[model samples]
Structure formats: structure tokens, C-alpha cells
Target: MDGQRDEGYVVVVNSEEQYSVWPQGRELPAGWRETGERGSRESCLAHIDEVWTDMRPLTLRREMADGTGR
Candidate 1:
């Protein structure tokens, strides 16, 4: 399958803001919600790369923000 013209994918995010590509028109797993961006898998992954700059999970980020993660 061509990356540019595949079955299509949707960008989904969890509470941690971690992103992943899910099959378009399929039910997302629990705790994951669509970021409203849908396109080729490559595009979805690119979107994840751009938006998920901080690789830390939400809880860890909060802890770091509170100066406790260290």
C-alpha cells in the first residue's frame, strides 16, 4: 500500500497527549480521542511528530511542573 494513498488514518490522543494513528472510521480504544485530524498514516504520524514535542506523559509533566518529577 502506498503511504500517500493508503486506507487513511486518524490522529488519536490519550490523556497524556501521546499521539497515534488509528484506522479511519474505526472505533478508537478506550481513553483515546481523535484530534480531528485524519488523512494518510504518514500524514497522521507527521502531525504527531509536530504536536507531540514533549515526549513526557501528562502525569510526569505535571510532576515536573510541580518540581517533583526530578
Candidate 2:
């Protein structure tokens, strides 16, 4: 946990035209519906705000080896 932590974001879109934004490397919870136009854009934005507000920060090790090294 002492190493520098990197942050990233991703937006997932499903066949139904619905989507959810999540911290890039993590999996969305089971049964969490990620897509649909059921809610307005404002609602979706608000939901994202609410969910990310409480998410714990993630720490990751850097992958420094390049193509030559691998």
C-alpha cells in the first residue's frame, strides 16, 4: 500500500443501450444493471456521483516492463 496509486474511470455500455460508469479496474457488483434509458441523463449522472462518492480508493502496482523486456 505504500506505492503510488493510480485512478481511472470506465463507462460500460450493454446491448440495451444502458450503461454504468465504474472505477476502471473493478468489476461491477452482481445484479447491478449497467444499461438502459430508464432514467434521465441527470438521474444517471446523479447516481454516478452518489456511488463514486463512497467508493474506496484503489492502489495498484505499476507494470513497467516493456515489449523488449517481456
Candidate 3:
């Protein structure tokens, strides 16, 4: 089988005072989606901050078994 994996980090800066790092295309934990859409940008940023904090660290990597790293 041939397949390709894309990996990267997402830095969400909803506002100046708050931000979050979403690794490997992973969505923020449950409830965060709702939080990001509600109220002010600051509030959304704060929600991201709270969700990402203390979560396990992540390392993104993509290697193709077929040797094409596509």
C-alpha cells in the first residue's frame, strides 16, 4: 500500500494575550471547539490556552513506507 502523511504544528493566536500550539493536526480537546466560537477572541484564546496547557507533548513526523515521503 502507498500512502502519505502530512504533519505540522498549528499556532492559534486568537488574541495578543493568549495562544495555543496544536500539534500534528490534532484538534483541541473536547469543549474547546465551542469555546473558540463563543464570546470574544480573548475568551477563545484563553480557552485554547487552558486546553493545551498540561497536555502531553507531541512530535510530528511523516515517513513514507514506500520511500516517497509524499
Model 1 TM-score relative to the real fold: 0.87
- Checking candidate 3 for backbone clashes, the offending pairs are none
Tens-digit per-residue lDDT, 1-70, candidate 3: 1231322334454322234544434567643322233433345455667666533322112234345454
Which rank order by lDDT, best down to worst?
Answer: 1, 2, 3
User: Residue by residue across 1-70, what tens digits does model 1's lDDT show?
Assistant: 6343464789999998888988887788999999999888888888889999999899999999999987
lDDT (C-alpha) at residue 36 in model 3: 31
How much lDDT does candidate 3 score?
0.41
Model 1 spans with C-alpha error above 4 angstroms: 1-7
User: What does each candidate score in C-alpha RMSD?
Assistant: 2.6, 16.1, 16.5
Predicted structure 2, TM vs. truth? 0.29
Each prediction's whole-model lDDT (CA): 0.87, 0.43, 0.41
Give the winner by lDDT: 2 or 3: 2
Q: Give candidate 2's whole-model lDDT.
A: 0.43
Candidate 2 pairs with clashing backbones: 18-35, 18-36, 19-35
